[model samples]
Target chain A: MKVVTKDKGVYSFSPAHKPVEYVKPGELIILETEDAVGGQIKSEDTPLESIDWSRVNKATGPIYVEGAEKGDTLVVDILDIEVADRGVILVVPGAGILGDSKFEPRVKIAEIRDGLVLFDGLRLPMRPMIGTIGVAPEKGEIPTATPHRHGGNMDCVEVMRSARLYLPVFVDGALFAAGDLHAIQEDGELCVASIEVEGRILLRFSLIKHKAPEWPIVELDDHYSILTADEDLDKAVKLASEQAVKALMRAKGWPFEKAYMFGSIGVKLAINQGVDPKKGARAIIPKTLVTLNDLLIESD
Target chain B: MKVVTKDKGVYSFSPAHKPVEYVKPGELIILETEDAVGGQIKSEDTPLESIDWSRVNKATGPIYVEGAEKGDTLVVDILDIEVADRGVILVVPGAGILGDSKFEPRVKIAEIRDGLVLFDGLRLPMRPMIGTIGVAPEKGEIPTATPHRHGGNMDCVEVMRSARLYLPVFVDGALFAAGDLHAIQEDGELCVASIEVEGRILLRFSLIKHKAPEWPIVELDDHYSILTADEDLDKAVKLASEQAVKALMRAKGWPFEKAYMFGSIGVKLAINQGVDPKKGARAIIPKTLVTLNDLLIESD
Candidate 1:
């Protein structure tokens, strides 16, 4: 397997960026990712004022996939995410929901050991996840902090180990990058930060020609989910739910109303990152209610 | 044990409503609740246009608590919820996120059997929950379809068996009423409906003088959650997160900023009912992170 280290990371998603490495479709890769703050906070005593905001969310690649082209789907099967020994979570003055007026800056460093992230006396289960992953967009450069169709900083907890993330390929080579690993995070991530951490991610990549999804799609053990991002959380939710309903309509040949109703009865709308510049929402449809064979396009 | 049936159901929450029954603190009661539409749709073939909009959401009581008074908390420990044999889910025009623009009025009937909801060959696990539960408000009457400080149609799935719901007592007697049972529902209930069913609810009541929450709270096996409802989903999320932070600050004697940061790392904000007129959002904090003894005010 090929290995991509954090030293080769980029801070933005752009089609103009050259690939750091090239690998064939269906190849496995091990990616070493930096924390969301890009290793700036080294200890609990590190001052939040000393950190550079411009250097945050550095993604680990634009790993070129051989034979991948525009209008195709880039399938990244997440096998494992091993948390680093130490991590830092910082709540700065101007960031997150409470913002500057209500909250002063603070930092907490956590240690990963014995299947838990230790924060003083509190021990939370270690659930490592990739916070940002995306392919190159169509034209302009998008900073790594924003999430859109090119899937950046989604911050969804379900984007954990064993989930398969499917990204739409807008540019040739399907330039895929990922980083900002977290030890654990609750849904909504209301204050805009989780247990920010560093980690090693293992993934297998494949291409589905001419079958691109409008937004990122994640296939979990028992469900299929579509993620959408927008400034308005309600709009994000509506967009994601619409995608789910479209998939159901295509698969079951049901009317839009029936598909929408089925979504109401079975699909779960989850908040991914509520405090981001582009907040994200997801519609998760249980696989038990609809089979994989039905959801995927037959022509592909 | 006393039993209250749907024959004593009311369409609004008001302190002036007479109590259909009375029970002392620590006494058990079994209540029979009608569906959200007041049992309007009987079968799959039932016309969506026939449902009377004015008669919807008939909650089954204003069951008076013998000793509950103003400025207190009415504790209702839910023991069990047995779903009825059949239920209806309707998505009508001019309702839900899709409303009249993208979706047409439609109805679905699901059968409850063998601990599953049978819907068109798909068997969904039976997760029975109370869609509405509340004490009468202090002021003017509020419809049964809206949820607020005096909890109404929260539509939260966690309010099921073995959960304890704490509602604020604004007036004397803590006139409690509950109905609108659901056999199964997703978190957001996006299309404005669920497996709307009737059910028998078993509960034990208690009163905590001068310790009422600003919103409804639920204590489950692994977590404690505060539910908030508003027309703006973002505002609702903010309100719920604030309540969670307040609880954390009161519990650990931490400053507001530290408590808010703790909430950002550990508390989960979940959408309860997005399609309702008053959108619902809940902040859930894991019990492992904070003990019950620390969260409750001992002075009460």
Candidate 2:
């Protein structure tokens, strides 16, 4: 099938967006997406407020894949990210985790020069990835600021190119929307900004028919990440551990007690987003240390 | 000149408790301190309402160091840790970040088996370090649970052997107190309970005259860590960045604005402790990444 071009603003997921009508396990779909700001902020733009907020973080089309059911998992294979011309921007404003008083008005722009993100006389190797990508939430329209079960605004740097993000399907057609492309960002993006740039995001999606998790479970090549949020870091970790245990139970058919015990023995926790002061804390638990072979579950 | 051994009775750091005489920097001091529970709960002790709340987290003596005055930095180098032949126990009750509802009565004992901390069938490589060690607050005596500028209960895992922690001297003689040794603990010790053990803590202190931070700073072989505690992670990172900027400014002689801009260009922020639940959020900026050469400060 021919890939969709940019002129077609409204791309249908069934035939136009997805490369193939039916996606097999480990299948790939390289869907290209626009930048988070949607060309609102340009290099010549002086004041940041000149950019409209309503159009910011406008995601790509809802990439619908065949055989992606509610209980299935959509493995988004982020193959490659290419910056055509303009680079990303890092802005600190009143809306983010850092309130107005702490941050002064400053805009840091990046230029993809010689395959590197050049910012303020420093060259940062670009590792581009989608900042916000998720299926529709159950209740109200979730903003791009918060990360939910749908896997929006995860901002985890490890989910860069070549990483596989396993998102649980919610609504029919999965209604996957992805954008907010970043050139490079630290784990928490504590500044509430990154080298946000206009780039083309290419990702392939595959369908895995498994029981849906209560939340999103991301699996990179060597690591398994469980997204969890809580009022505090301690509670966030506990909630993450609980989610890990639940994932373990689902994957291994072990009892809750056994999963809990096993987690205490082997599970290691990592903080994903600690700088977002208001919404409590967010973290991810990688399953690299915990082997499926060690569990009671049989591999496919 | 001579190191003092354990004194009889519970060693307390209160004003009423006897002060341990000072030694020069780089001199080893062996201290014997009660567990965080302060002997209220023993090996076989069960959770009960009779526990003394004030006695909990009672620190050892305020080992007054010789030549340690205000404006000097106390470099506490952890030398060694040796748990008693018996063991230690961990209990989850009113302690930790979890509320009373999630509280459960459970105990796990630790034993040194095969050079590893053994609890039931689990064998964890021992990484022993004092949990609470700091100078008396400038204003008055502060509880060990609340970590402050004095470095009480930082619960930083990096404070292990070979890692030198620089504490700011507030009062004369730098009244140093140390206790709450844990055999092994994850970053946050989320349960608020690590393998709490009664172990002999051996530490050497070195005085860096005329060099003290507003808050404590930790230095390992490869990285420098700034300690800051705030309700929000973003604020904590900002505090850490501010400290790093100041350090860079002092080291390079750059203006504050230049230092801040330089930091944005170079430094990498890491989430130090997102598990503390209460004080879990910490950010570490790598000194190597910052352009120290641009700053006009001299390096020692």
Candidate 3:
């Protein structure tokens, strides 16, 4: 078992960065993560303007996996996520879906105990999830705050423990990185931030050779979601829906028309993170209808 | 109980139409509805081009409720949905999210028995819902295929039995109509059609005088979703999120910031229908956090 500490973090995902640790396929590893704000907000009384914005969204190590190469799909199984005792949620002045609305910069520190998030005498269900996770892209560097085909900062709710994330591999050895844990987050992450927390994730990686999806996919118990991001949700949803329909067509060995019609009865489209500049959307296909093999297309 | 038969249906919702039935606020009524295609696709062998497109989406009634008037919110509780033994699904040549894509005008009829929608050896979960339900608008007419503040063909999955739908009243008596039943449908309704079925809906309407929202809303067991539709999903989602944040602000009596921040941890943004010309989106807020009173703004 290997463990990458929180101190080793990267501000962006790029092939230029050296791998912090290297492991063989099927090897189990642990990733220690810092909060999205880089632990800058110490308490509710902490001034919001004092923190450095550039240092925010620091993701932990690009752990390279042997045998993971370009034209392959990196399957990372998230086994467990253990969050810290406390987390923070913030409201920024000009960030979020409601950017034009005026608001005082406020921060609230929440307690995490007994598998519940306690805020103002209310107990919220704890649904721990990874907020930022990605591998190096084929070409350029992507900031930790954005999500692209290579998967960065896709604050998707399904990226939780007991789910398997399928990221398209690019660059040899597959420099993978993940951080920004949330104790509990709803689908949209509407106000720009969630109950951001420090945590440790236990995961294992495997490779699907010569097959990769156009975008990242998350496999859960009953469904697989195709994730996409663009400057707006319309483009993202269109791409996700198209890819999902294609996968369904392949799975059922049917023409595009039948698959397209059947998708209305089975596939669900949702927003993952609405507040980011590149809004994230997903097309969730039921496992009863499609499979992992259907989503990944072989690249000749 | 008064019953509105399927034969007395209207193609468009307008203030110019005559009310078929009248009832008190608390009185329950049954609405007999035709399928989205006006019950024309009787079997899989039926040609898709044979059906009259102009007769599609015929709502059963413009039921007038006593004491219901303009500037009021009409709250209708969906008691039960009794679907017929058969349903039809279709893929029109150019009538879906993938409208531009080439496809044959295909039609498929499904069997509904033992509380299940059986389609081609697959037993889909029966989640019968209202596809088109609305009151007459303040002025002019809106075709039943489009959704707006008046709540026409929202295609929202949550508009099922046990849910409560809130529609804003425009003209006096809240001239309400509901039809277009779906035996089962996913969130996006990605394709043009779903398991369209004829059904009977049992519902009762109550009113909140002088209190109305900017859009229609659906109240499920654990959450309330504000529904909005626009030419694009981005605009719909933007308006929905802002309204949800505003509701939170009223619920907790907190200034804009705290409610906006907490909304990130509590609210969800989702698509109800993507195929319609006006894409429908919603902001689902947890019932544990906000009450229905918070959503109904005083119009006076």
Candidate 4:
């Protein structure tokens, strides 16, 4: 077990360019995180006339997982989250999907009180979840705010407690970094923000070899989730459906057409993320009616 | 209130097509309903090899609401549901989103025991909600299975108890009919079906003269919802965003651009329906973020 702190813009223990050592499954690692804005703004601070957008959204790590190959899945088991006295603030400028002209001089502040995030006289149950948690993509550095195949900024609420997130290991060691904690957020976070806050997160990581998905997949207590993103909701849904069908096919060994038909006839589809315009849509196909054990998987 | 029953594909009612009427902001009305199949299939009966598709979704009646004019909004308040001994069943074949392929023969049976619908091995908390409740469309008779401006076959689980559903009125009397009760369902009944059953429903209807929206709007406690459907998810989301902007503009008299901007900066979106291939997407917007009080036409 190891503990690390991120002060200002520097990490207490910065790793070199090489891959960091891996920690086995059920190992506890604690990381103290900063607010999404990196403490640039305070509670009494007024809305910025012009924000230094570039300085925001800094992730904490490329913490390498041991033995995690390209095709393997990195299981991030979120153990617990401790919110700081100060939380996150959300601002929507002119560049979002609704565009900029409609919202102006908008600033909403949330406070963590009695285990709840209070915003605009509404008491949202404080369900601390990560705003951005993912691995590095194969190419250039992907912005922490943008969600992609590497699972950045998913803004998915169900990734909260007791959920095991299985992310595809794109690069070796699966350079993992997580920050931008939210006290509470709806699925879309339509207003483009949630109760963003600084927090301490405890996560347990495990590596599964030779078991990587083309995209990320999640398995919770009662449901299985498939994540897919596209600039278009239709295309995104189609991609998600295709992936879900493929998962079903692999799990059930049913013919492709039969899997598709079973999905159409028995599965349930849910929209996971839609507010992020860049990654137009994300859907989840839950194996609710059909039991996973009923399907016989034929090894590839 | 009127009582009706169907036996052997034949129905008899005390008040037949006599336009059941209620006022705006009225209390819940209890209606005794028949199954979607209209008694064509029974508890012991097997799935029909060929269901009369036309007759598969026959609803109870066109209950005309008093003072509901074209362009007005009808608020249907679901109160409670009481399922009978035997419920409904779903069979997938040539119809549905995956109509292109054949699936294995699967059957699910349901029973109501002590206010719970026991389906398979799960005891789903009975939250009786309508699967087909709507006004007559401006066009010719639309099937009970398809949803349109009239709000037919919405199958939205949130439209249950304590939720207020607003339907845009098309015809003079606002011919409202409701049936196809379900015990429970997720956001998208990806199986293209739910725990469909025959149940007694209690609902209250009210009318709002000048508050009719361009599309359906639902209010569940503090959250507001907008339903949209298109050939694709992007278009569907765009349509939903546009509708949400329109609702905000109409309610707050903000400029269209401002509404869009406000939505971009402040709203949250959720997928309401995805089972239908033709139209699959629903977006939810919070009323608190959008300044609706500015356009308040004498608040209720």
Candidate 5:
């Protein structure tokens, strides 16, 4: 397996960035990713406010997936996420869901051992997940700070190990990149940060030809998570739930009302991160109720 | 166990209504609830639009708790929810989160048996939950169609069997009422309807002396869910997460930043229902992470 090192990090996902590594479909590779803060605040002794913002969210790669073309779906099976022994979490005063609340800058370094995140005096079971992962957009570029149609920085907890993320291919070769790993994170990520850690992601790339859902989709153990994002949380919820209903209608050959009614009883609309510029919303539908093919029904 | 029949239903929760049923603390009682449509539309035979809108959301009782007072917290332990054999689900064109979407008014009658909701050629596991359950507000009357701090029509799926719901008392006797049992429902009732069904709710009432959470708090088997509502989802998300962080801060004697950071990695902010007049949002914190006392730390 080829390892894409952390030195090949990109600040933004763009078609302008040339591919640093090339691999054929079904080729498994490892990408060494840096933390969200570029792994700069090692122990939090440094002031969080003075850190260079430009160096933030540095993602590793624009790994070219051969045979992945525009209008195709890039299938990335997340096999495993191996994290470092230690990670960092910080609370910046003006940078979270509760940004207006009076709070000083605080930081904590956590130790990962025996499958638990040892923080302060509490031990939480490790749930390592990828926070930033996607391909180039249709036109220009999307910064690693925002998530949209091309799936950047979604911060969805369901993007963990054993999940398969399907991204809409906008540019040829699916200029794929991923970074910002979290050892563990809650659903909303209220403070805009989690147990940010550097890790190596093991994933295999494949392609679904000429068929792609409007937004990204992640297949978990028992459910399909429709990842959709918008600046407005209400709009995000609309997009996510609409996609689920549309797909279910297409799958079962049911009319609009039947699909809409089934969605009310079957799909869960959850928030991924409310603090992000493009707040993440997901529709979690059980595999027993919906399938990968069902979600791709709107393919053009 | 004493049973409170379905005929004692009220269209709105109010201090104006006289007590219909009275019970001592820790006394188990059953409230036989009407469907959301007040059992008007029995099956697909009746035209959905033709139903009497005036007779909607008929909840059962003003079950007065003997010892519950204005300053105390009324503890309601949900023993069991026995749903009726048949339930109806309808999609109205001008209602719900996707209200603007082109859809016809379609009704589905689901059969409940063997712990399964047998729908249109599909068998789904039955998970019954309460949709409208609350006490009277401090001053004015609130219709059963809207949810607020007083907790009406929340449509929260976690309000299911085996969940202990803690509500804040406003007036004497804690004038409690509940109805709108859903045979099964997703997190966000996007279509404004689930498997709308009538059911009997078995409950026991108790009191937490002079202490109450600002919003409703439900104790599930593994986690404590803080239910909050707002006209705007962003505000609801803010309220839910703020309560979680504030409670955690008071619990472990941690300062602002520490609690904020912990919340990002621990508390899950979930959307309960977006289609309601007041959208429901909840912060789901694991029991091992934060106790019920931690959440009630702000009580005076």
Candidate 6:
């Protein structure tokens, strides 16, 4: 068991980034995270425009998992999330889809209590989710705000409690970082922001040697999803669909055409988020249609 | 009650297309439908390349609803669907996301019996849906293959039994056409086709005078969705999001920003289909999130 608290988080996910903690597989670790803005906006009086943009989206740690080699799959199962008393939401002009339009930046403080996030007398059920979680890439550095094969700020809401996220290891001792917690967010996060909160996350890690996928895969209670993020949503969706088709092919021992046909009528494509930096599309294949045993690895 | 049987279906949706039968509002109608390929591909011997593309996607009727004038909303409530004994699925080499990649054109006939579509020794529960359904446009013709404001070929799987579809009326008599039945389809319909089948459909129509949305809206058992179709999936998603925001604004009597914020975390965005002449996106707003009274129409 390890409890790692890195106050100074990294602004990017890179192989060059130093690991804050080292732990073996089959271990439980606790991570304390800062908000997406790196704790810049404190209260209602905090001016949104005054925050430094370059210092935002700081991820907690590149926790090195021992014995995790390149091409391995890092299974990070979410155990629990404990949110702070307050969360921040900002409407920054020129940052999201509403960018181009001019308006005074607005900041609001949400109180997290009684299993709800209360803002301006409106109550929203608390569904805490990690907005950024990834492993170090093999090549150039990718900003924590961008999402790619290495899985940066995907902002997918489905990566929540009890979900198992599988990340492909690109370097030896897979450098994993997780932060940017949100109390609640819809599928699109269309406002370019969610109810950002600081929280402590509990995760259990396991390594599947040589079983890594090209992108991230999330196994939820009801379905398994292949998450793909690209600036162009069409391309993202295509990639996700291809990944699902590939999974079907590998699992069912079917040819490409047969797999493609099955995917067309069996896979469900969901939009994780469709605005700015990266547009995410998740191809969700229901477990009822394809059991986990069917998706078992042939070798690895 | 009115029974309209138009064997000669139309390939396009047009304001000029004559109505096969005219009926008063609140009347029930029974219409028989052809498949997406217009029932041309019969068996294994059917040549995939020789089928006429011009005659594809044949919708049974532009059955007119009397007193359904422009600016009114045509409410088509799907009551029932009776699928045929057999259905067809095709993997045309040049069609869908598989385009540019070469593969032998494959066709499979699925047996619809005992409430399942049996194909390749696999049984899929029959979830018959109307793939193409729309009202006439205001001006030019819209092909039944394309989904637009007039709601042509949406190809959404949610438009199934017990759902209510709202289409904006643009002509004196709302000319509603529906066909392209599918025995079952996943969300994306990635292979460009589903279990295409000929079927009989029962619909009940009602006119909401001077209260219509610019785009198509579907009221499912649990949620309301605003459907948008564009070649670019991103733009389509944006449009759908905006529509959901608009609904929230109109329904909750909130300002634009408040509605947008509510929509960001409360609504769900789904990809109806991402590969084709039209990339479909649906912003699904759960009924639990917004009450019907909040979505009250301000005007047509």
Please report the candidate that would top TM-score against the real structure: 5
What digit string (tens of lDDT, one per residue) describes model 1 on residues A1-300?
Answer: 999998888899999898998889778899899899989998878888899988899999889999888888889999999888888887877677666446678888888899898875678788888999999998988999899998988998888999998888888888889999989888887667778888899999998877678889899988988899999888888888778888887767888878777777788888887889888889888776666544444333
CA error at residue A187 for candidate 6, angstroms: 1.3
Q: Considering summed lDDT, which 10 consecutive residues are worst modelled in model 6 chain B?
A: B291-300
Which parts of model 1 have CA positions greater than 4 angstroms off?
A293-300, B293-300
lDDT of 3 by residue, A187-244 (tens): 8888889999999999999999999999999999999999999998878888888998
Question: lDDT rank, highest first?
Answer: 3, 5, 1, 6, 4, 2
Ten-residue region with minimum lDDT total, candidate 3 chain A:
A95-104
lDDT of 6 at B278: 89
- Sorted into a CAPRI-style docking class, model 2 comes out as acceptable
- Local lDDT at B106 for model 6: 83
DockQ: the better of candidates 2 and 3 = 3
lDDT per residue for candidate 5 within A15-103, as digits (tens), equals 99999899999888999999998888877687887778899898899999998888899999999999999999998878888999998
lDDT of 3 by residue, B101-131 (tens): 8878888888999888887788987899999
Work out candidate 1's RMSD over C-alphas.
2.0
State the C-alpha lDDT per candidate.
0.85, 0.59, 0.91, 0.62, 0.90, 0.84
DockQ of all models, two decimals each: 0.68, 0.26, 0.78, 0.24, 0.84, 0.67
The C-alpha stretches of model 3 lying farther than 4 A from their native spots are: none
True contacts kept of 2: 0.05
Candidate 6 accuracy as TM-score: 0.96
Q: How much is the lDDT of residue B131 in candidate 1?
A: 93
lDDT, residue B101, candidate 2 = 28
A117-186 per-residue lDDT for model 2 (tens digits): 7755557777676777677554456665556667776666666777767777755567676666777765
In candidate 6 the C-alpha lDDT for residue B170 amounts to 88
Which residue pairs in candidate 6 collide? Answer: B251-B294
Off by over 4 Å in 5: A297-300, B297-300
How well does chain A score by TM in each candidate? 0.96, 0.78, 0.98, 0.86, 0.97, 0.94
Compare candidates 3 and 4 on DockQ and give the better one: 3
Top DockQ prediction, candidate number: 5
Per-residue accuracy of model 4 over B172-244 as CA lDDT, tens digit each: 7677777777766655554566666776777788887865766676777776777666545555666666666
- TM-scores of all candidate predictions against the true structure: 0.95, 0.82, 0.97, 0.75, 0.98, 0.96
